[model samples]
Target: MSFPQLLTPEEKLAQGKTALGIRDVVVLCGSMRFAADMAEVAIQESVAGALVLKPDCNMKIAHPLWADPVEAEALKVRLDDQHKQKIRLADRVIVVGDYIGDSTRGEIAYARELGKPIRFTDPEVDPGEPGGDPAAEETAR
Candidate 1:
């Protein structure tokens, strides 16, 4: 049996459709510690036809002032605000890990406050399936 080939994000967006037909914008929220995982999820979502947005994890090294704790914290707050704005522009928010860190939790709460739907990538859940705890799905909406 021949299986269908998956399309790249560019191809998917070019087609203007997805398996779920949810081609709206999505904001990916996760800890900087899981930057790679966040990027993977962003790519997957983008391929699945969502316009995915993620923080620039490379900003720390690009800005030398962020090496200082005070400066880093201030920059973090500014970045977090920018992410919240992205969430405001998104149709939904996808948290990228099984464990929610402090920052991720804050982003989730902010997304909830703005009435955006939330989804999570839980290891216990099948990756091939629409994932996230049902309780969280209910609460996010």
Candidate 2:
């Protein structure tokens, strides 16, 4: 009978490195308030050979001038759900912002629950970092 050979730790590490070289399907998550920033990050990731997915935060559709407050709130909920679905499909989530709002915070929590890797555009702005809250800094100004 032939035996199947198991891979050594070094062999497994090599395989992981090989896989890392392949393009990753990354989902960009952030508030619509920072849509432009999110788009910039998406473009940068795409240029780096990653398959990037971002929410369609086009101002034409989501602008408050067009929708009443009630309607706008409903739309925001729907859009947030869609973004969560995208995060479920992604290999990793990149949060693009200096200060994360409630929606982005929820997305980060969801991504953590799913055990996906999470990255931020500004490491200094992370909640755990010292002087991370821009609002505090602004108040001090």
The global C-alpha lDDT for each of the candidates, from Candidate 1 onward, is 0.71, 0.72
What's the lDDT for residue 2 in model 1?
100
Q: Encode model 1's per-residue lDDT on 65-106: one tens digit a residue.
A: 688888888887898888888887677877776667677777
7-110 per-residue lDDT for model 2 (tens digits): 97546744674687744778988766788898888888898888888988654455654368777767767888898888876778888888887877888778
- What TM-score should be assigned to candidate 1? 0.66
TM-score per model over all chains:
0.66, 0.66
Q: Which candidate number has the best lDDT?
A: 2
Error of 1 at 90 (Å): 0.7
* lDDT, model 1, position 133: 44
| Runs in model 2 lying further than 4 Å from the true structure | 1-23, 58-66, 128-141
| Model 1 misplacement above 4 A | 1-23, 58-65, 123-141
Candidate 1 Cα lDDT to native: 0.71
